[model samples]
Target: MGGPSENPELWAFLESLHLGETLSGTITAIERFGVFVALDDGPNHPVFPGVGFISIPELSWRRFEAASDVVQVGQRVSCEFLQLDTWNLEARLSLRATQPDPFQAFADRNAVGQKLRGHVTKLVPFGVFVQVANGIEGLIHLQELTWTPLKAPSDVVQVGDEVTVVVTQIDRELRRLVLSRRQASPDHL
Candidate 1:
């Protein structure tokens, strides 16, 4: 037995066990639960086999309403293995997990005044969740969502809409990412 990281060949072999490792594979089957990825790893690999599963929560690095929208049968994707159980032969992988944080890049790219494109993920009475990039979610508070007088934030934007936003604040210590749609779009006012 070899440590997962130590054994390059074994690591590569184990990585091929899941969907995200290598996108080159056929969708051997699809079921109500999830799609299956057929790899050249072994013979007789079951379609929806074993305890290994990529739950909806683990599917994306960012928050999404529907899992199916992000993935489908016969789609190729590269992913990073989060965990694996040799005993149970279970593997947990993530497509975005393997990628670097966009917010970090945002912070690096712009000091403060830079603009970014963000998609609405959640709408609340107080604010909205905007995905600036994969694994990077910024909050657009009711006050920040719009400059106009609004009774509710949802009036300005609905979930899944892409809007331009300005980086108002980035609190890495508190893990807070703040953006202002109002500032980003002055014409909207």
Candidate 2:
């Protein structure tokens, strides 16, 4: 099939929208992969259901179980224009852009070696997710969970267990926060 370049009208419409600009639209469809939006000002998409598209990751800044948890069909929403999705024949949009990034806010106020207390949110083979702040979860790798040896994170901590952790690394660009429980211990020094 042809791309947006072949459809001059859609191409012009998509190009008219600058990145980070706010666009209003109605949620036309929600799929496992992304959400579709019928832009209030753009032409109808020649292929898809809508001229605007929001990927699953762009739907929210916080973790969610599903797209429906953050938005529903027919919901009027404002999104930040991310780019022209020529491959998908739609304008890529971001709902998360319209909201403050909790991770960024968390990073700005905290630094490495800082101690934080939060409950365990999840356990995995390699690490545990701890919510150090609202909508912000830091990963404590199995090696960092404690100085002791363990076969799994569950061996030491379970979901909802409150624990003190020290921020080990903050990768702002990647939006990752690494934590260490072993260092948080008073005797670690």
Q: lDDT at 26 for candidate 1?
A: 40
lDDT of 1 by residue, 104-180 (tens): 67566665666999799888888999988767888888888777777887787889898999988887565578888
Encode model 2's per-residue lDDT on 1-189: one tens digit a residue.
376557888888887888889999999999999999999999998778899999999999999999999999999999999987767778899999999998998989999999999999999999999999999999999988777778999888899999999999999999999999988995752
Q: Rate the local accuracy (lDDT) of all candidates.
A: 0.64, 0.91
Q: Estimate each model's TM-score.
A: 0.54, 0.91
* Residue 137, model 1, lDDT: 84
Pick the lDDT winner: 2
TM-score of 1: 0.54
Error (Å) of candidate 1 at residue 22 is: 6.7
